[model samples]
Target: METMTTSHSLRSTSINPANLIELELLSQIVTQKQSANDIRGSIPYLAKMAQIIDNQRLETTVAASSPQQQQLQQQQHTLRLLQADAHRQLGQAYMKIGQYIQAEASLTITIQRLESLLKDDNAATSHSIIVNQLIEGYDLLKECFELLGKPHMVQGMENRKRKYTTPAPAPTQATASKDKSSP
Candidate 1:
């Protein structure tokens, strides 16, 4: 297992180039020789050790991703849940610093991902075999977004509601005429 070239770095922390290189080399040695944990002390280690963790994680993901779409789906489901939690935490952090717009954006991403997951019966419903819990999660996500208090999100929600509640407006005559002229 190895990291894919197209893998996006996580937002939790940026991997320092030096640390990434060192850790990746160490990772190779560790994997090849299956040595003891004492091998970790050889280099200038990253304080948070983000690169090492990401290296292992990226390897695992790549290996699993090579298998099938079912594997990909499961991975995506887990990632979405994790992303929601990360966004919530990030939003809270941003709010504490008075960065309300950043907070709102992060929370909105959280809420939107959760909502999308719920709507995807495959992701949410597939989690358990006995029953469909997707709708329950859907409602919870709706509440979460409302709690976040973003004006645009609320407006978007309202617009979506109206779209479903009211039928689509009849097409304009000019558009109808143009359509009729098409072969």
Candidate 2:
């Protein structure tokens, strides 16, 4: 399975010119280290790289305006999603290193940001894409809590997961009968 996007492809097709250089460099580092043998050893470096990308994205987002503002906002949103993915990866790495506290912190950030982005009115991205991301985020977070021996936290994650994954309730017989009568 493909695990990472190459910097070249990201640069050529998706990234805006304003974020080109920084994002390319960050993506290169992330892609190269993704399959490294010493994944736990790479957590700090990966987390720092993700932080740098997020800081740049924040600065660009704050400065957005005028005719390019809408386009820039969309690009920055995409960058934020990438940043969240980096954080999730870093969290998993932290988990491998037995750093439950750090893992929980990183995973919490990923889940929160992803949930926020999924709430955006202008987010025209695929619903399944965002939902899948949330599922991954929550799954990792639940693992982190379990490893930390935090049953309450684990329960919370489970509840959130069910909320997202469970189908809506089927209409009650009374409601169905009322509907037929109205028609």
Best by TM-score: 2
Best-fitting candidate, scored by lDDT: 2
What TM-scores do the predictions have?
A: 0.37, 0.73
Task: Write one digit per residue (lDDT tens) for candidate 2, span 1-183.
Answer: 966756645343244455656656756766666667666556656777677657653334455467567776666678778878878888888888889898898899899878888787354555568788899999999999988899999999999999889999999999999999994
Q: What does the lDDT come to for candidate 2? A: 0.77
Model 2 deviation from the true structure expressed as Cα RMSD, one decimal place: 8.8
lDDT tens digits, residues 1-183, model 1?
A: 987564465322233456557656754654443244332332123212322333433213444444555665655566566556545545544554555665566566665666666566464345442122223323333444566675566666555445334666899999999999999
Pairs in steric clash, model 1: none
